[model samples]
Target: MIESPGLLLTLLAFVLVIGPLVFVHEMGHYLAARWFGVKADAFSIGFGREIAGWTDRRGTRWKLGWMPLGGYVRFAGDMNAVSQPSAEWLALPEEERNQTFQAKPVWQRAIIVAAGPVVNFLLAMLILGGFAMAYGDTRTPPVVGTVLENSAAARAGLQPGDRIVRLGDRDIHVFEDMLSYTRIHPAEKTTVAFERNGQVQTLPVTIGVDQQTDRFGNNYRIGMLGIARGDRVTVPVSLFEAPVVAVRRTGEIVSMMVETIGQIITGRRSVKELGGPLSIAKVSGEQITLGADAFVFLIALVSINLGFINLLPVPMLDGGHLLFYAIEAVRRKPVGPEVQEWAFRGGLAAILGLMLLVTFNDLGNFGLWQSLASLIG
Candidate 1:
């Protein structure tokens, strides 16, 4: 059972983590709309009834919502928070129509829709770059300093002083690269290449799986190579190079996310590993306990994920709007309102279904279902 302090921390951490992200995301849209001279009717941090907020000089109804799940920017002449074009708003007089979102050219509308996710990516890059500049980067060579006795590396003929060159098809540049590759391929047979005394050799090794339980009793299964790294080097990155490092790191993270999703699609990974708001809250709390650095790192990771998820071509998402704009560009006319309405409905259903699945997974992870079963029994 969670203690009172821990529970409170989790709640606070969740708000701290999610609130800023939501605000940043919506602000991106609002800013882009304003740049195109589109009037904003409302700017909310969350959904549902307003908790507290004040209007800006531009007459935007900037308000806080009671439900803190997500947020939206309702542009003037929008039918709803999703920014669907209102028939009456579209039929406004020429002078007034100029300030509505739908009155803008297709390119402008697309930019406004795309800005939210782009800002999310930018936010992540900025945070990561700041860390790189402040703490420097770790540059540990992927040389095996020790091979654990009777472990997979030992059985595979790996020895001390072997400089790991590649794992399967992935080239191991640093120790962290090797670790990243191994962590995702637990219990799978993989090819390892290393150099010893100027001679390169390859061997097949089945990665060992290690099941670990965290302080919160959450279990994780990770792959282990049973080989340790040598000394590490920390290099200070220059201001000009920090952005390059941040972009590279962000790309690597996106690649990992893509690979994980591909694994799930191929049935190589379990869908039960999928998480929702509860899992995020738990993780946020745990990271807060670790330190501000750890918690901030979590924010960057989640920001990238939010950006990537929004880019998926699902209806009702930013990507979905872009997809519609793409179709409109090709046809030289907007998609039929009936078609858009149906597509959005379908999208909403898919999103709701996914939420239910993830929530169920979160409950199981928290042992809620198991505890209820035990109580009934």
Candidate 2:
């Protein structure tokens, strides 16, 4: 735990940011389960020894535990939640198990399992779009700030103070819009139109691909037309329409996540870009240092990540359970208990291995191991 201030920040970040996200995610599942009439025996916000608790009228134990990394909902007939096998529950006498999870319809079961992550995603998008509409977006004007010498833009006669009017036939208003359009369609030739001082002109510039290397020694080819980010402009939201901002933001986050997944598969993105607990802690600490807004934004971003990670089709996650439900929906029966047990074991191993690898990487990144080595020497 002892390291630089940055490391302290990272660890603190995990506790503050990740804890709430975990709470929100579990709450989603709990709410959905209740909606489906599944009787929850205990709802815990953390694990280990209980810190504070109270029983509800329905006999549900609502408690807060000492540890704060994650939480869980114990249903009436669940065998400790993480391993709630359907076959065992089905064997219970009909007179004894109306409120058991196994008795729920497939649709309800699927919804209850899937709701946790879905709510997190929705929360992220709403914050993004709502903030955008409320504060207006900070954007750069199309005006060029500085043209790098011998860079493609400079070589192609792009001058300082030139206001970019359009890319191809697409008229760009803000800096972000231009950046977004250029990133996806990295064309070799771009007919860029701009206004020089007061006069409009056009520059047909050849795009050059730049190679950048990762920490893992992987290389990525990034195309650039030699233009730099411009000065920002903030456009505020109008009256009576700021509420829909969050919805738009949610769509944008979903689009970004989808693109990230696609890029990783296509080798356009590096897998190393995916961080583990260490990364979360580091980002959490860094954002907290920047003040309240940045801190809140980091919290929401981490929440989105939590949701996305759980949604992956890996066997031990909520998504894995949903996958089983999906299979059940198709086959009109659950996969065998033996298969489920093996799948669970394999999935659990994969999760543990991944956690260990990411933790090692994080420690190295934070110089924890190296610092200890030096001290021992």
Candidate 3:
């Protein structure tokens, strides 16, 4: 279990990781608003009680809140952090309406809303690209590190220091290549060819599903390779080669996101895999312990997640507002207040419900719920 120092470190890492990212996200909206001549009433870091605040030269309240989960930019006439425009406030005189967000052109409003997520994704891409160029990549060699006792590898007489040449007849380029293919090919028999002590050997091994329970007691059948990776090599490249690696990494992230979404919809994956603030904190602390490079990489991944989530087409979100604004741009008139209100409400409900479920999963991941269940059972 992660102890007290790890807990404190995790909390600190959460703040350090999320704080600047959220600030950057909100700042995009603020800057866009200013550019479009819209006044922001507040620019806050975090939510809940304001521990410290001061009005800037532009009369915008810059505050740091006690709760450090998220932050926002409150445009004039907005009832809350989200850029959902206010209608009642627009009923004031022309001078007051001019300051209201509802009075802005749809194009301008859309820009302000979309800017937040755009900045986050761009920032993430930059971080990922920089890391790739700076550190290069590490990969395991196709050599056997350690074979589990009495497992398939041992039964087949496989030993350490055996360099895997191929899986079946296919040539293996790297160690991960062998691992990835093997994970999905569970419950099948395959011939593994390797070079051991200057001699080529062929070993036939049978793959099987291993049932394991998560911290929440949820069972999963995982395919095991019965080996620990030990032989590895690092490939270094010039800065010129870094962007290519970064672009590949970014593509991989997007692909994973798409695959995960599809798996969830297809029931191949469970919602229990979805994480929230607590999960982020746990990962942040663990990554920080891994090193600065790992910590930065995790932040970039989260930044991408934050960006992708905001772009979802749901009311009250940036993407939702973009959708509405696009409609208004086409029709040359805003949607009715009642309709917008209901849509926003529905979106809010969905987001809140998802938050609650993910929070439950987070607690489950921490094993708190399992402990209670054990006591009761």
Candidate 4:
């Protein structure tokens, strides 16, 4: 028997990080359903066989599942966890049908479907706003303190005291902003604008690529520029201003996610960079070791990702449902059941394929293939 404390910690951290997010996401759907007089038949925090559960006064089955991956709310009139309407449900008694999810106005149904992702985004913003209020915000200027020998910055004629004002089309307000831009554009040539000696200068340089490995052996390839910031400063944000700061920070994170996806699609970044549940587990464990704040920050980051992903226009996702609702509104009718079924099938396959790809990447990152090969040899 092999017992590793790190493995245990990773498992524990994965549960801790994913549990609340899933609950919050499902709760959003549940609450919206309740608000619109739609009955939720079951509220689940996970999938597969139920470990433990209870029937609430409203007859909603609240349950915990064996798997801790994802969760859902099964509403009345819904055929499955994805909230697809059932033919039998539509034929129900008029009085009972009124309380079913499918009976709601298309606008109301759209809101119910959108609430999950919206709440996820809100949860992230709340956590980030709390951090901004408690610890203030970083306001370091984008001044170059040192130019490493033969670095991208050095090759671009960047020197100490040069203040980066822009990268490509993005305005760099701080050193961190510049870092964020460069990190996603690795090995890509881009124009940089900076101020030096009271004059603004612009030059094109190829961002360097750097491979980083965590203690858990997970690897990341990120963009790098061979320049260091001059100094760092944290300025206290007022309570009223904290929300603004949080919103801006959240937007920046989302922007980076979009940019990264664009890079991947454009073949500038490899698809191997995509991570799945295993990566989340490893990073959650590592963050917990760093401290509570670090772990909480990771939670917020993952929460944002969850929201962004669900908003994708892929079938079976919240965004896909919303897309259907939009079409219904425009056409004055819901999409045909046959079309929806086929779309859902395609969506499920795409999601499954993505899961497989990410899991393979995670295993590869952990050197599972090499270990198995060595043992076989």
Candidate 5:
């Protein structure tokens, strides 16, 4: 575990960020269950030995656990924290069964299972909406005010007053779009369509690559066109419109995530890019150091990511449960319990394998393994 002051701060930041996110996710399940008259046995913020806890008046044990990485809620009929049904639930009296989660309608069960991810998405929307309402969009238009000499823009015959209309197939809406799109394609040939005076013109340009370093000493290569913003515009959205903007932004992030996953699965990208708890801690610490707005924005981003990850069709996840429920709905009966048990077991194994892989990647990211190897050498 990280023990240095900076690393400790990172650890604290991870908890501060992850704690609320996990709470919100499980809270979604808890609230939905309560709404449907299902009794919750416990609501926990972590796993293993309890650090602190108290039973609520409703007999729900609210507790914090030693492991601060993840959490769950135990319903009345649950065999364990994963919400598997217990045999006792099956043999319970009608009154007791009525209060159990499995006793509810399958639709209700699906809702309860799905509510965690839904709440995560909603939490992200709320945070993003809050940001939009507070700061508004301060971005500028994608018009070239000046083209640097000997840069990609100048070489492409780009001149002052040219308004960029498109980059390849993507329609340019603002200067941020141009910068964001180009920044990833260093040293690559790209087609730029712009409006010069009254006519639209297209140009073939090779993006310039620029290497830069962050405060963390990590280096990155970014594409550069060397064009400055022509005019700035701040569009302040109404509270009503903020959520819509937030949703659109969330959609963008989700789309990018999906694309990245597809790339990874298709071998276009490496699985080494996948991050675990250490990456989150590092990024969370960096964001916290930036300021409240940046940290909250990071929270929104991570929350959305959490929601999306849980929606995957892998067993032992919220999405896996939903998938089973969908199959049950179509079949008009639940999958056999033995099949579920095996499936969940397999799911658990898959999850553990993935966790280990990502943790190894995290260790590599922190240079721990490299340090150990060098020490041994």
Candidate 6:
């Protein structure tokens, strides 16, 4: 139900972003299968009806599907894209059975299944590193240059030219470190240690929570100490050093995701923050407008998100496959087929339910339901 120019932009941006990501993900599976001597039936970039494709020399059908949301690779013995063993593969001639996916050694199958997400992480790191190499890192010192009147810092007797040394038990190295700590603990009181006139003083300060909304209409609460930096410092980085930075960047993002997911699961964070395809499409469009660097960064962030999510120990995910392998290693055989079937069904149901919930949230974020209610009223 997208309309006109905005619809066009969303579609274009979504395809541009998702197409490469899906392609790369599936390609990882495809290449690993080839390496392991496992025959691949189809290499698809999307789901459902095929739009266009050609059969490769290796007898793999490489096709693009109409739905741009997800893609999968079907190995010779896969019951479906999830790589379940098919009856056909089970009944294959003894000689050809070796080519089937389930027939492969557990380690080989695990490698093939793992390659997809592994490639995603690598792709994000490469993009991030390239960005770092092109644009030097911008940093700001943790020194307090100014304090707003009546703000938390001023109320706590903080003055300009004080250097923040610690918050609670954590040491503050830069402005970002302080910002990150504050963002997670809005309105919470913590001890702040700062150096004044060469003397270190620790004071109890209650953080001020500010409610803010982004252009996308998502609301967030941040802790404000009302401090400002003189100027941002730009540090030049070499191409060789970029990958190291990229690794750290990816680790930081992954750590943040883990923390957020834990909070959401523990009910410490609102589920309304969960998003779906619509949110991604909107952000993709927005980032496309922001310029190549921003869009590329968004892609890397999403790629990391994708990789990490897939590795969660949930059934129907890459990590689920790994879990099964772990159990198989311990039990000296695969889990019962019936148990796997039920687990996979339940996993699919859970995935579908989450999708519905997130899609509803996306609608709310887009003001679609609000506009409709207004029209009706």
Return the TM-score for each candidate structure.
0.94, 0.75, 0.74, 0.94, 0.89, 0.89
Residue 105 error, candidate 3, Å: 2.0
Candidate 5 regions exceeding 4 Å error are 1-5, 80-87, 148-160, 184-191, 197-209, 221-226
For model 6, give the RMSD to the true fold.
3.1
Show where candidate 6 strays beyond 4 Å: 1-5, 80-88, 165-171, 188-205, 213-220
Indicate the TM-score of model 4. Answer: 0.94
Q: How much lDDT does each candidate structure score? A: 0.89, 0.75, 0.79, 0.90, 0.87, 0.83
- lDDT string for model 6 (1-377, tens) is 22223778878988888889888888888889889898888988888999999998978898989898989888877765445566766788976777778888888888988898999999999998887788777667888888988888898888888989899766887777787777766677889999989999999999888899766455678788888776878788798889898898788788768867776888867798899899899888878876888888889988888888888878898888888988888898888778887888888898899999999999998889999999999
Q: What does each candidate score in C-alpha RMSD?
A: 2.0, 5.8, 6.1, 2.5, 3.2, 3.1
lDDT of model 2 at residue 315? 84
Per-residue CA lDDT of model 4 for 1-377, tens digit only, reads 32223988989999999999999988998999899999988999989999999999999999999999999898888765445567677678998888988889999999998999989999999999999999989989999999999899999999999999999989999888998998888898889999999999999999998998666454567888899887788999888998899899999999999988997898877898888999899888888887899999999999999999999999989999999989989999888888888899999999999999999988977789889999999
Superposed by TM-score, candidate 4 places the C-alpha of residue 305 at a distance from the truth, in angstroms, of: 0.9
Candidate 6 has an lDDT of 0.83
User: Which candidate, 3 or 6, has the higher lDDT?
Assistant: 6
lDDT of 2 by residue, 1-377 (tens): 22233666667766888777877888898899888777888988889999999999988999998987578888888863344546666777775477878778788888998999998887776667667765886666877777777776787798888888887656877666566555544435778888887898888876666777643333456666567765567778754455465665555565667776786678866565656776777767766766777888877777787888898888879899999989989999887767887888899999999888778777776668999999999
Indicate the TM-score of model 1. Answer: 0.94
Compute the lDDT of residue 71 as modeled in candidate 3. Answer: 90
lDDT of 5 by residue, 1-377 (tens): 32233877788889989999999999999999999999999999999999999999999999999999899898888764445456766788888788888888789999998999999999999988888888896568889999999999999999999999998666888898888767756677879999998899999999898898777655566789989886678899898989898897788778768866875788755688889988899888887887888888999999999999999988899998999899989999888778887888999999999999999998998889999999999
Candidate 1 overall lDDT versus native:
0.89
Of 3 and 4, the candidate ahead on TM-score is 4
Sort order, lDDT high to low:
4, 1, 5, 6, 3, 2
Deviation from native of the Cα of residue 78 in model 5, angstroms: 1.3
Span of ten consecutive residues with least summed lDDT in model 5:
1-10
